[model samples]
Target: MEYIGSRVINASRATIANILADIRRLPEWNPAILSVTAIDPRVLVGKPYSIRAKLPGSPTIIYEQVSTDYVVWHLDGLQAHETGAWKLVSLADQKTEVTHTITHSGAIFRMLAGAFRTVPGLRLDRLQRRAEFGQERAGREN
Candidate 1:
């Protein structure tokens, strides 16, 4: 099962790219991510990193991530096993588009994620929140 999400931030691609380049800033905008840490070489293409997160009301879990321009997170669980990606695409007129996609490979995964399939909606909400936060942060620094 492949779940895809995309959003356009009301900001320049350069600004968005700068934020994307810094994985440590995720908590400021990513609602689903409770916290992120650079356990290895940090956010560099072709490098490996580890991240720990608290999934809503669930216990904290750790996942392995590999960065390659596009980053992929491999998550393991009793009911669901999947891979998720964060991709950045720059458009003309200083626009930036970010797409987040997830694909589940395990049998129990679909059943488990059925209730959580509302991710696309959640992402849309987070997109607006993140854009506002980014805009304000950028304004303050300028």
Candidate 2:
């Protein structure tokens, strides 16, 4: 199963990409992420990082690809395997269009597919708010 979401953010592509690349700061913007503990603090492709989320499992996620405009990561959980990709397109006036895609596999994911459908959209909404306003302001608004 796949879930996709897109949002136009008021920040530049570099700004948005930088935020995405910094896995350690995920919890600051993504509410579903509780914390991230990386083996290496720097984001090197192929290195695995463990993320504790609001959900049931603490998945080991790896950065498969990272570039100026896109990023791809794979998450291995006890019950599911997921691949997440982010594509960024620069727009006029320092804006960026970000598309987040998640492909899920495994029996558990297949059975709970409907419940996960909204995950991507919710993450994108939080990311947009974080990019447009500072974390402090976004938190207040939320």
Candidate 3:
């Protein structure tokens, strides 16, 4: 199963990219993420990170970094390894297009994946809303 979501933040691509690159700030933008701990504090492109997040049922979910720019947490180990990404693209003028993509693969995931497809998109929506709210708050402060 593959799912994609995009959002336009009032901030620049650089700002959005910086937010995405910092694992620690995920909870501020991503509602599903409660805490993110970089197993290795390095900012290398392929570094591994560990994330502890809250799921729909209030259960904590632990996920591990799989490869470059990808993290996989087993929804049911036997069912699927959930893959997700954040891609920032510079658009015309001063706009930035942020795309979040997720893919689930496995026999069990295929059977039950549709039930979870809405999750990634909803998370991305929350992130975008947070960004917009931050921008509005900053504007008011100035």
Ranking by lDDT: 2, 3, 1
Backbone clash count for every predicted candidate, in the order shown: 0, 0, 0
Judge candidate 1 against the unseen true structure and give its global Cα lDDT, from 0 to 1: 0.56
lDDT digits (tens) for residues 73-110 of candidate 2: 88887788888899999887668889999999977788
Model 3 C-alpha lDDT versus the unseen true structure: 0.57
Clashing pairs in 3: none
For model 2, what is the alpha-carbon lDDT of residue 141?
57
* Residue 12 local lDDT, model 2: 76
What's the distance in Å from true for residue 76, model 1? Answer: 4.4
Q: What is the lDDT of residue 94 in candidate 1?
A: 48
Q: Write the per-residue lDDT of candidate 1 for residues 60-119, one digit (tens) a residue.
A: 223344332355656554455657676766665545576778777655755565655666
TM-scores vs. true structure, each candidate: 0.61, 0.85, 0.63
Cα-based lDDT for every prediction = 0.56, 0.80, 0.57
Candidate with more favorable, higher TM-score: 1 or 2: 2
- Candidate 1: lDDT of 119? 69
